[model samples]
Every structure is written in structure tokens, then in C-alpha cells.
Target: MLQGVAVWAQTDPGPQRIARFEAVEGSIQFQSAADNQTRLADPRWPLAAGDRVWAAAGSRGELNAGGAIVRVGDGADITFTALDERNAQIRLTAGTLGVVLRDIPPGDRFEIDTPNLAVVLDRPGRWRLDVDPQRNTTRVTAEQGSGTLYGEGGQPLAFNAPQSREYAFRSLAGSQPLALNSGDAFDRWSNERDRALAQSPSLRYASADIPGVAQLDAYGDWGNDPRYGAIWYPRSVAADWAPYRNGHWEFIPPWGWTWVDDAPWGFAPFHYGRWEQAGNRWGWIPGPPQRRQPYAPALPFGGARPNIPQGVPPGFRPPMQHPMAPQRIGAPIEPLADQVRRDQWERTQRAQQDQHQADMQRQQQMREAQQRFQPSYGQRQLDEQRRQIEQQQQQQMFQQRHQQEQLMRQDQQQQMQRMAEQQARQRQIQQDQMQRQPMQPAMQPQMPQRMQPQAQPQVQPQAAPQAPMMRQGGVQNRGGGEPGGRGSHGGPPPNH
Candidate 1:
């Protein structure tokens, strides 16, 4: 059953979940693969593979793909190129993108490409990619962990922390070093968003691992329900609002026919669990955290399979623009300058979260016994582990380019091994089939000059014909190889 209502990406594979985007400012429109129609992109729309996302001159877009998050700059045209279990690649046709990664599992890759250069990230890092279509150049700034920039001719350039590089659209034109770019309007804005998410009033209400909880802070308020734990009520939705009414249905592999909600705070509530209506209001119930994450939940769609356009899972369709009255849905959310209590808030929830983590881990263990790694512990453990890993990396970080190549080699080797195993199995099957088949007569090679063909048998042996039945005695003569076989129906064996 399609369980998750608003799963972010497609396929059951890890890291393939779509990236949820919330329009922070200006005019951003998304173009789906099936219908070239462009609609004003809304917040909480998950950008899956083959989807093209663009921001108008002054508009900005923020996307969150599970643990990885990015902010798209103005006048930028970016496409979701490829996304799967171990890798994600986005292509920038114009403008800039800011990325911040909290963790990157080994054997996994994150990449961004422009006309002339390709940037690949294998470690936890924060960086920015800028494409100058008019100038035929690209710029990169590494804010945190190191990554590599590869030129068109496959030349590689290293980008250590606090490093910047520029490249012209030339044949193997090497990257030029530039001063670190840390402060700018975009940077400030990005920082502000982090701070907002960090201090969101909803932190106490939802799971910390919930991807887009940060954006919900300024958009909605939490209400206590007698029936469904903590429920978030959006400020703009009408009193009669219900889930799935405004979203379109599209199929994502593994989990088919996912619902893409238009609400900015739609991700967490829709993907995690169920929604219930009480009195004149509707509330989201984020079910208990499970070991496995869903791409989207099973939304009740009146037993109908919504239209699926693309031939693939990581495909997209234009935003379904249902006639919506602005006031009837939601109004602008004004930021509230409430007292920031992140420290105290976390302190109070520490014990609760620890217990929750233990429960989640146990549940995950049951659901995915074959999983090698699980986020069963609290954030502290993960942070400490990441810190130690980073320290070790800093010591050996200069060899990043070589490491990239080595990882690539390892992936290729694994692929080759899989192919060889498949070929071997095929060959074994063919051999087994040949062995089971009946052998045909072998033609005698042209006998030596004087040899002659052997004569064929004149007659073949046959079973002796049975005697006619002696119906008068109610008996019939039957032949048998063994002696003393029953001569007829065996009526006291006519004393012979």
C-alpha cells in the first residue's frame, strides 16, 4: 500500500527522496516534465528527478532533501538531473545555488554541474555553485568540508575549507584560486533561515529528524488535541480545510501515486502519518517515528489511481493549479519575535528524546534487520561521531582528489563484480539446460577411404501378439516375460 502521503522523493532506495522546496521570496516557478506549463512554485513541493525549478529575478527557493538542504538564488534555472540511493546530481543552467550538508554516508555522492565544470562532494560540507551564462564562467566557494572541481577535459581542482575557485568555459582551463566569500546578502539570508529553524516554536511539538520542521515555525502554530498529540494548524487554511484537496496525485516508484501538497509546512505532517478532523478543524497526526522513512503516506483518494504521466518513478508533472481563493486558503504569515528558548527547550526534551530514540531504534531493528547503520541514538552521538570523523579527515584531507578517484574505482569494481556474477549464473543455467536435453545420433565422420557404412537392422524386436480371448470360458490369454504369470482372469487356474 502507498503509505506515506507526502514522501519527498521517488523509489524505495535511500537518498532518492525528492527535495522539498519552500519559496522564501520572489517569483519561482516549476516546470514538470509532462506538461511544460509553469505555475508559481509553492512551498513544500518536493522537486523530484527530471523536474525543472527556476527562480525569477528576485525570487529565492529553499529545498530540503532529507539531510541535505539547498537554497536557490535569484534568476537561476536548475534541474534535478539524477537522484538515487547513493548519489544526487543537479545541473545549473544559470545563476547560483547554496548547499549545506550535515552528513554524507560513505559510498554516497552529491554533485553539481555547470556548462564547463563539475563539482562533486563526498564529505559533509557547505558550498555554493554559481554559473555565469553570459560570461561563460563558473564560481565555487567551499565554506566547510573539501570537494573537487573537475574541468571539461577532466582536470581536477581541490577546494579545501574556506577556499574559492573560478573557472572559464575553456578546454581543461584550470580553476583559479580566489579569496573566501563569506559575507553577502544571500549569506545573511541563509544564516537567518538557519537561525529561524533553530528557534522555531514547533521544535517542542515534532520530531527533530523531521526535515522541514524549521520552515513551519513562522507559518503555523501548534495546538494540543485531546485525540492527536500535538497538531500544527496553518495560519492561512480555511476552517473547513482538509488534506489532499489542493494537491495533485503522481506516482513515485516503490510507493506509487504520491501527493504533493502546496502548503509550505506540508512535508512533515503529510509524509509522516495521518490527519484527522475534530469539530470544525483539521489536524495532522505525525505517527510514532519508525525505522524506515516513507516517500509519501497512503492518502485516501476515493480508490482511484491518479494520472501518472512519465514512464519513470523520479518523474514530474506541472503543479496542478486548482482555482484557489487566497483568503479561503491562507494569508501571509508574519514573523513573531518570541523569546528564543532553544537551549532550555532542548534541555527539557533531552530525556524524552533519548527514550524516543531508543523506541525508534527498536522499531527500526524489527522492520529492517539487514540495515547496517541506523540513527537510533540522539543527535549528540551523531555530532560527536561527525566531529571525530572531521578531525581525522582534516589530517588527511589534502588527498581528497585521490580519495574521490579511489571511491569511484571502488564503485566501478562493485558494478563489475555484479555483472560478472550475473554472467556466470547465465552460463551455468545454459550448461544445465544442455546437459538435460536428449542427445541426438552423432553422424559418423566420412569413414576412412576403404571403410563402408554398416548395414541397418532388417527387423526390430517386438512384443509377442496376445492370443485371442476365449470368451466361452470368460478368460483371455495374456503374455508375460516372467514364468507362471496369470494365464487368464485366473479362475482357479483351470487345473492344467
Candidate 2:
């Protein structure tokens, strides 16, 4: 392990914590402490003290310093005045910034200095600071945190959540109460980003103390290893891909020859862990969670040398010899120049052959894994197709049932209508028959018959008296009254 350790000539104590550009939107640039020239910012680029970041108009940038998340709005300029184990200081020159101090280490200090005041974070919470150079004012909004603002020759003004205050740059005699306005697009974007990072799945595997761990959830997956405990493997990498291959090196002062990866999820793994080959895939082992790991400039392996840029600053003195140089036993006979050249050529050939073999092996392993997964993938596709067919069949059956029910209802309605019409037609027929029938004459009541004359035998011989009889059918009847007998006029007699 000692032989593999990289040696560096340090001018100052190494920073236990460093900030990296976690995200960038639109035009953003930075000036490094070692190189004063401004360059386009890369998300993987590590930030140190004396470095300045600028977000041009219509641009934004975000930085992750340990667990603290810092976001700069459009047209903002900020400088990392100090960043180390126990202190993080930022100088805001213009525009707005949103800082979320999720967890401040014990005895650690986080401060933001503006033209008007120096805002020192006192607790872990959300904070927003705005520097208006035109108005010569600094505004502090403690959206969900507490901090103290120190001004020139004035009392330290302490502000807490749900508070906003504005102070003049020249004097801090008093601060005017300002309304908390988080409705702006910048604040909304910052808050949304913070919420997403807070819920990253990578948090469960890696320690939050590691900067850029939040990005791992998007570009990689975490797995449990029996030997390495928790390890992370990057997704969508080529079979021949290896750590520190897709990045360039820049001599960042204090820590020379830093690696800047092109990958988005490249910071924390390269800076804080050891890479191991488990099977054919490379995984990052974040060491033991119990231990505090210092930031490393690069974790190169396989006798890799730093690609130092030209025109290095005079202050940075590279090592006199390669750190990996072997020890010599006494003073051996020096080799001829031709012999040295021949030995160098042989070593280069061996290294190239070794690299080629490793790449071929990795490719073979990937092909095998793909072969093993193909059947399962095909099975999943068949299962999905079956499910879709079943769903379609069920849906068609339901539609058919619905249509049948509707037709049955229509049939029942038609049957009922027919029955009603038939009944109505029968009623009409009965009414017409009743109107066609003939009428009969009313009957008159019969009168009682007169009593028959009591046997008048002797007096009838003297004279035949005329007796009036009822007229029947326009004929008069003259005869002796008899009971229930026919009259002389041939009409039926009435009842006696």
C-alpha cells in the first residue's frame, strides 16, 4: 500500500473538503488559482480557494462543498475565499445565490462576504443572499435557516427563518425589513434542485460527507459486495472503459496534476475512493464509512503518469524524480544510452500488449453477460405481449357485454311498446262495436183486468146490456168477461 501511495510536494495542508462544480447551465466560466486565465467550467472540475466562478447573463451554476449546496443565479460572480476542513468562505460580488447548509460539521464555519455585510451561517438551513452593486446593497433572506450579519462598526444582526433584511453597503446603522420572495424563477429552480438532491438514492450507499455523491444516483448503480461492502458501478460505459481514462489533467496548485473527468458522476469516485476490478466491471470502493477521507487530486493506477500542462507556474515545483522510481542498490554499472533506449522500447511494447489483452478480456466478459441476459430479456418481452393481449381480450369482452346489454334493453322497450299499442287497439275496436249496435224501445206497464161479472143468469134474459171493452189493435171487443180467455176481437185477454 505504501509503494502504491502517490507523493506530492505540498505547500499548504491538504483540504479535507473541496468544492466541485456540481452543475452548470448555459454560459459559465471560472478562473483557477494556479492559472489566472478564465476558462469554461466543467462540472467535474474541483474548486479550491482563490478560484472565482462567474455565471453570465442567462446562465447559472451550482457547487457542492461537502454537504453544503451552493447555487449562483444569472450574472452572478463569486469567489472561494477559503475552503478547507473547518472553514468555507465565499465572496459574492454580484447577482443572487442560494445556499443550503444541510449539515455543518461541528466547529466548522460557513460565511458569505458581500460588499455590505459578512453573513455567517449559524445553523443548517436554507439561505439566500443577493448583492446589488448598482444599488450598493446586500440582501439576506433566511428562507429556512439562521445566520448573523456583521457590518462595519455595527452590532451583528442575527436573522432566522421567514426573515428578509436589506442593508446599505456604506452603513449598517439599520436594516430594512424586506418581504421574503421565493417566487422568482432562480429561487424556484434552486429549491427544486435541492429537493432532488436531498432525495438521491446514492445517499444510502455513500456518506454525505463526500462531495458529488448526489450525482451518482443518476449515472450509476450501487451494489453490496462481500469484500468491499458498498461499491458503485458506473452505467453505460464501454467495455474497455477504465477510471481516469476519459479525463484530462491540470496542475491545480497546492495539489498538482488534478484529474477532471468528462463524466458527470466522476468527481466523488475519483477523488474519494479506490477503484477495483470485480469480475470484468470496475467498481468504486468508498473506503470505510467510519473513517474521514481526505480529498485526493487523482487516484491513478498501473504506473500512470500525470499529463502536466505546459508553462506551469514557477511557484509549483514538480518532484525531482518519479514517485514510482525504484530504489537502487549501491552504485551499479551505468547502462549505455543505446541499451537504455532498447529497454524503454521493450517496456512500451509489453505495456501495450498487456492493455490490449485486458481490453479483450473485458469485451469477452461483457459478451457473455449479454448472452446470459438475452433469454431473460426475451422472456420479459413475451410476458409483456401476453399481458397486453389478455388486456385487449378482456376489454373487447367488456365492450361486447356492454353492447349486448344495450340491445337487450332496447328489445325489452320495444316489446313493452308493442303490448301497449295492442291494448290500445283492442280498446278502440271495442268502442267502435259499441257505437254500431241497435237500440231497443222501452216497454209499457200492463194494467190490472176487471173482475168478471158474478153469474147473472136470470136478469140477462130481460135485456142484453152494452159493456165497454178495451180497444185492442183499433178493434172494439163485446163479450162476457172471462178469466184468461180470448176476446171476440181475437186479442189475448188480460189477466183476471
- Over 1-496, each residue of candidate 1 has an lDDT whose tens digit, in order, gives 1221123333342233566664468888887654555667755445566778888887777887655777898788988887655677889989889888766777878899899788888688888888899999888888899887787678786667887877788544555688777577778888887776678676566643355666677787778776545667677877656666666555543344555666757676656544555456666554433222334433221111233333434454322322322221111111011101433465579978999999999998887865555555686598888999999998687689779999999999999999998678658755853554344356633322222242111111123233232222222232322223233222221111
lDDT value, residue 161 of candidate 1? 85
Model 1: per-residue Cα lDDT at residue 308:
33
lDDT of 1 at 185: 72
Pairs clashing within candidate 2: none
Candidate 1 — number of clashing residue pairs? 15
Q: Rate the local accuracy (lDDT) of all candidates.
A: 0.61, 0.71
List, in order, the clash count of every candidate structure.
Answer: 15, 0
Off by more than 4 A, model 2: 1-14, 288-292, 300-496
Q: What is the lDDT of residue 187 in candidate 1?
A: 81
What is the C-alpha RMSD, rounded to one decimal, of candidate 1? 30.6
lDDT of 2 by residue, 418-451 (tens): 9998678658755753453233235634543333
